[model samples]
Structure formats: C-alpha cells, structure tokens
Target chain A: MNSELPFLVELIVSAFILTGAGFAVIGALGLARMPDFYMRVHLPTAGTTLGVGCTLIASVIYFSFSLQTLSLHEFLISMFLFITAPVSSHMMAKVALHTGVRYVSHTQGRPWPSRTQRPSRDNSQILTEWPKRP
Target chain B: MLRIAVIIAMLMFTVSVLLNLYRMVRGPDLADRILTLDSLYVNAIAMIILLGIFLGSTLFFEAAMLIAMMGFVGTVAVCKYLLRGNIIE
Candidate 1:
C-alpha cells in the first residue's frame, strides 16, 4: 500500500521479508520436531540470527526508501540479536550440560564426562573448588 | 505485492510462535522450556517489526528494541539461576 515506493524496491523488500519469515517457520519446525534438548537448542539460533537479520534488513530498506532518509536504527535490533542470540544459546547449553539433559543415542559423544570425571585438569580443579550448597 | 507479502509473513510468524508455544508446553527439561521462552520473545519482536513495517510507522521500533533487551536479560538471568541456583551471586 506504500504508493511512494518504486516497484523494484517493493520487490526487494517483499523478497527479503518472505525469506525471513520462511526461515523463521523452518527454524520453529525444527524446534518442534527435534528429538533432543541440545538439538532443539540449535534450532532457535537460526531464527534469531539469520531470520531476524533478513527481516531487519528489509525493514531498513523499506523505511529508508519510503521516508527518504537513512533508517539505520533497525541495525540496533539486528546487532543486539546477533550478539545475544549466541550468548543466550550458549548459556542455555551450559545449563543443559550442568543439568545433564538427555540426548539422542546417535550423538557423536556417546557419554559425556560426569562432573567428577571432567576431561580437563583445570575443569576438575574448578569443579572441586566449586561449593556444593545444600 | 508488498502488502500481500507482509500479510503472509505475519501469518508465518504467527505459526512460528505457535510452534514455540507447543515446545514450551511439552518440553521435558527446564532448560528446554527456558530456551523456548527465549526464542518466543525473539519471534514476538519480529512480529512487532513486521507490524511496524505494514503500518508505515516507526513507533514500534522502540518497543521491539525494548523487547530485545529485556528478553536477553531475562534469558541470561534465568540461565544464571539454573546454573548456580542464585541469580545475583
């Protein structure tokens, strides 16, 4: 409905928007279908990073062209998402590791090291020093 | 074309949100639920942004940004709580 925008700009914007949405849907499908917690954890990063990134880019292009001004503000959201998505995913994965969430049998690492039998000396030292509060 | 695309995109995002909801409800592990919550907020932000674009208004950008910040902080805080059993320590 934005009449001011040219045909090519509209085409580009729509393409990007559709692509982003498709990616989001695919990611969500993976989240819903993945067999294990760790696999499910990997799916959302696809949505948060690339899916949102494409939509943000489309928004930037649409607004910048429509308003006849540089609309770089969406970059803030994009950058924030890019940085935080991975961090949050990493943290969640850490929580999974700490909680010993179950994984599929086909997973390459069949048996994760137990807390008492950590693979590294430094990690063992840290685990030993870590207080176990009841 | 653009309007149609926006409408379709909105519907897809809605479907995605619903999928996330399903995962959240059915997740067997606490970490799984938390991860679903994190992605849920991100999808919500995308929906807000799409709405803003459809309406040709910049007002929703701030709301999207706020959601981004708050979602990240909440995820991190919850993760910390799960890891150490205390958020601030």
Candidate 2:
C-alpha cells in the first residue's frame, strides 16, 4: 500500500491541533486583559464555547485519524461544555448584579429581571414621600 | 512521541494553573477570582485528557469529566452564595 494517506491525515490532524491551541491562547488573553468583571464574564464564554469546543473536536479528529476509527468521547465532552459554560456565566452575572456590582454607574436604581416592580410615573406620587427607594 | 507532547502540555498547564492562581490571589473582586478558578478547571480537564492519552488509559478521562461537572456545580454554588448570601435562599 502507498503511504500518501498517512501524510495527508497527519497534516489535517496537525492543523486541528494548531487551531485549538490558538483558540485557547485567545481565551487566556481575554481573561488576563478584560477591563472589568462584566467584560471578563463575556471573555471566557468565548473560550469555553469556541475554544474548548474546537480543542475537543481536534482531539477527536486527531485520535480518530491516528487510530483509524472514530474516537467519539471528545465530541461528547465538547457538548457537555457547550451546555454548562453559559449557565455558569449567567449565574455569575446574576450573582454580581445581586451583590450590587453595578453593570453601569447610571442605572443603579432599576430592579433586575423586571422594571414593573417599581412604581410607574402614574404612581410616582407615593415614592415622592418614601425617599424614592433608590 | 506522544509522551513528550503530553509532558509539554502538562508543563504548559502547570504554568496556566499558576497564572490563574495569581489572578485568584490578586483579583480586585470576588467575581474575578471565581472566573480564574473556573478557567483553572478547563485547563485541568485538558491536562488530564492529555495525560490519559500519554499513559494509554481512559481512566483519567473519567476524572476529567467529573472535574468538569463538579467545577460547574462549584461555580454555581459560589455564584449563588454571592447572589443570595446563601445557597438555599
């Protein structure tokens, strides 16, 4: 049998490895350099979703090519990451909001998840006496 | 050899773990520290996977999955605590 197939396969595998490594480095750089918590929260979402996703796919591709069969476990793990990282980031953001971390300096008075809990302009008569609840 | 590649990855992971530790230590706020810890989990999982491939076993993959699951739970728990000052509330 000619050896053309193995070289082509190895080249493809090496390409995947390089792509994964690049994504990982970008995620780390985001972690190191984001200006604040909210932005930082946005940063790792990219890492966990795209970076880890790419890395795991590369793992599966490399192993399957080398072993001449599908190595599917990496695909499963990547799916798990896709499900978990967003939930984690959302939870952290909620925590930050509840802890009064202030996503914006000017909008501190608005209650989260709803603006209906506070009085409308029609009901502003009541808050004028209670010091505005802000 | 794959073993050498795995070793190098492990060394890189060790460095990443330490760098995240530095962020955890000096993070200006709790959220930053938590973020760093979460990144540590991702790195740890990758390192464990590489180690498994190097050693010709699938067992470490089990540990890696467990770590990923547990790390998610831990991060949620910490966020809950920060949000409500209690997990149950």
Candidate 3:
C-alpha cells in the first residue's frame, strides 16, 4: 500500500515522456522545414498520434501507480486524437488543394484536377454531397 | 531522474510549439497557415499532458480533452470554409 513508486515504474514513465517529446519535436521540425505544404501536412501525424500516444501512456501509468487504481482514462484522449488526426489532416489537404496551394517544383504527381469540375468533390468524389442538417 | 526527464521534455515541447507558431505566421499561403494552426494545437495538447505528468495533477486531463475536441472542430470549420467559401449554406 506504499504510495511511493518503485524505480522501474519511474524509469518507464520517464522513457515514455522523453520519447513523446522527441517525436513531437521531430514532427514540428518537419512542419517548419518541409519544402511544400503537402509534405508539411504529413509531418504532424508523428506528433498527434505517436507523440500523444506515448505521453498518454506515461500519464496513465503514473496515475494508476500513484492512485493504486487502474486509471485508464488517458486512453480516451489518445483514442479521440487517433480518430480525429487523420480526418483533420485529410480536410486540411483538401482545403490546400481546393485553394490551390503550390507544391514544390519537383514534386512528382499528376497535376491536380482543375477547380472547374467540382470544388467539394475530388476526382473520386469521395464526398459527393455535403451533409444536410436534419 | 524523472524530474530531469520532465524538464527536458517540456523544453523540447516548448520549442516544438514555437516552431509551429513560426510556420503559422510566416505562411506564404492560407492553407499552409491553417495546417500549421492545426499542428500547433495538437502540439499544445502534448505539452499540456506532459505538464500534467510533471505536476502530478490529473486536473489537466480535462483541459487536454477539451483542447482536442475544439481543435478538431476549429480545423474542420476552417477547412470547410476554405473549401466551399461558406461554412453554412
């Protein structure tokens, strides 16, 4: 029933936190240094997903050990982040394309479809219709 | 040992946030700015969670959760406006 954490637990938590911070820094570096918006957009996934994941795991372990109860709630944040990060990134990329953000000169890909075909719909029309308020 | 780790991690995260802020301000394009804003919030949440661990307080979790939700909503709304030129139409 001792409240003090053992050495192993502290080490594990420290490892998680350090790893999380490292990933976050790497992600931010990519965002700042990348040559194009599309490349920059892909970088923060490192922070939003794995960076948060490691820190949350650290938090959960630290709390559960301190409180002597199985504290699993930090997972909720990571879960929500996991669900939202990709979607938010996708939306940002779409906006970038819709607004005609320029790619780096050497970026290899087919030219984006002209905005005339449809603004909301991509070539595949993944989201053909806007959601209506019920 | 843990204290040192927390200090180092927090320093790194602060630098990360600053990098995101630089991109947001220096953006040559609107979408690039928006993307940087989105990444900024996410990095902020990581910083908050790290703070929680450093301070040994669970209260910050609620703040982190709220940031996550609001950040997603804000990104979506802005992206929507950029895409369609109107949020509600």
Candidate 4:
C-alpha cells in the first residue's frame, strides 16, 4: 500500500471502472436495440472511446500502486484505440454507403438521401478524403 | 482496502466483457459485431491488467500488450475489407 495515498483514491478508481462498465453496457444495448446498421455502428463508440479510456486510467493507477512503476503502456493503448476506432467507423460507414446497402432512414426519405446529405460540407469532406484508387 | 477496490474493478471489467459479448451476438450488422469484438478485446486486456495487480505480479501486462496489438491490427484489416470488398487489392 502506498501509505501516502489517500483513502479517496480507491473510491475514485472504482467509480471510473464502474462508469466504463456502464458505457459499455449501453453501447451493447444500442447495438441490439437500434433499428438500423448505421445506428448500430454508433453504439460501440460508447464503449470503444469513453469506456476504454476510463478503464485504462484505472489500470494505470492500479498497476502504479501494485508495482510502484508507471504503466504508461496502457494509457498509450487507450489513446490509440480512441483515435483508430472512429477512423475505422468512418471507413465502415463509407463502405456501407458505397456497397449500396440502404440506410434505415435517410433525411430525404430514401436510402441514399443525396440532396439533403450532399449539401452538407462534412459529407463532401469525407468523400474527398477517401483514397482515390482505380 | 486495496483488495476491495481491486475486486470492484475486476467485477466491472467482467460486466463489460459480458455486455460486449451481447453486442457480438445480437448486433444488427457485421460492422457492429466487429466493433463489439474490439471492445471485448480492450475490456479483456483491462481485466487482465487488474488481475495482475490483484496478484501482485506484472506478468499479465505483457499479455495485455499483445492482445492490444492484435486487436488494432484486426480492426484495421476488417476496416480494409469493409472498404474495398477485398482486404488485398
């Protein structure tokens, strides 16, 4: 035990872990409960980004206490996951769009929703960013 | 007191694993299932780290690192497959 550490540290770490568990639970719930594939894609972000971040922090603290050594590796992994998961989600969503799978509900009442979806600058930005390959 | 906290962390990670598994089974889309697997990997890594702490050994840290590495590569491959319909073009 780190005699210098306050009692509240344990409670705080436990809370973070539980909060992560909560986010993961909701992500899974949304995955199952959502009506569409796009919606389902949104679900896992709850776990992948925020939940993993919290748990990694808890792990860092736990290991620091036990080994008295910095476990920066876990923290780095959490950051990597946060960055990659969303990038990949965007890729997956784009592929779903290009593959001609119909979205459950598009603002224009069609799967493609071109007019409403296209006018948005972000939409064009994503399209422009995609690698141009034959 | 530390034991109590460690136990709590272990239980929470276990819960996270179970929840992620639920998504893998029931998600409406393949992408969703893939993401769930990624989450399951991360959560499992965290749990293993906690177990290491609880056991007062650093051995599990290496395992966690390996799992994390595998998860990221696997996600990248799946993302590629989703994009091009073939992982190797």
Candidate 3, chain A: TM-score against the reference: 0.81
By TM-score, highest first, what's the ranking? Answer: 1, 3, 2, 4
Tens-place lDDT per residue, model 3, A40-96, is 888997554688899899999999998889988799999999999989889987887
On DockQ, the candidate that comes out on top is 1
Candidate 1: clashing pairs of residues? none
TM-score to native of every candidate shown: 0.90, 0.74, 0.88, 0.73
How do the residues B26-65 of candidate 3 rate in per-residue lDDT, one tens digit apiece? 8889988888888888888888887887778889989999
Residue lDDT tens for model 4, A70-120: 768776677667777777677766655654444565433444544323444
Q: After superposition, which runs of candidate 1 have C-alpha atoms over 4 Å from their true positions?
A: A110-134
Question: Residue by residue across B1-89, what tens digits does model 4's lDDT show?
Answer: 76676677577667657766776776655666666776677677767766765676667767877887788788778878766547878
| Predicted structure 3, TM vs. truth | 0.88
Clashing residue pairs in candidate 3 (N, C-alpha, C atoms within 3 angstroms): none
TM-score value, chain A, candidate 4: 0.70
Where does candidate 3 stray beyond 4 Å?
Answer: A1-3, A116-134
Model 4 interface CAPRI class:
acceptable
Clash number for model 4?
0
Docking class of 3: medium
Off by over 4 Å in 2: A1-5, A102-134, B1-15
Model 4 off-target regions past 4 Å? Answer: A1-6, A106-134, B1-9
Look at candidate 2 and give me any clashing residue pairs: none
Instruction: Mark the 10 consecutive residues where model 2 chain A has the least summed lDDT.
Output: A114-123
Candidate 2 residue-wise lDDT, B1-89, digit = tens:
33444455456556556666776786777888888888878877776666565554556656877888899889999988776557876
* Top candidate, metric TM-score: 1
TM-scores, chain A, per candidate: 0.81, 0.68, 0.81, 0.70
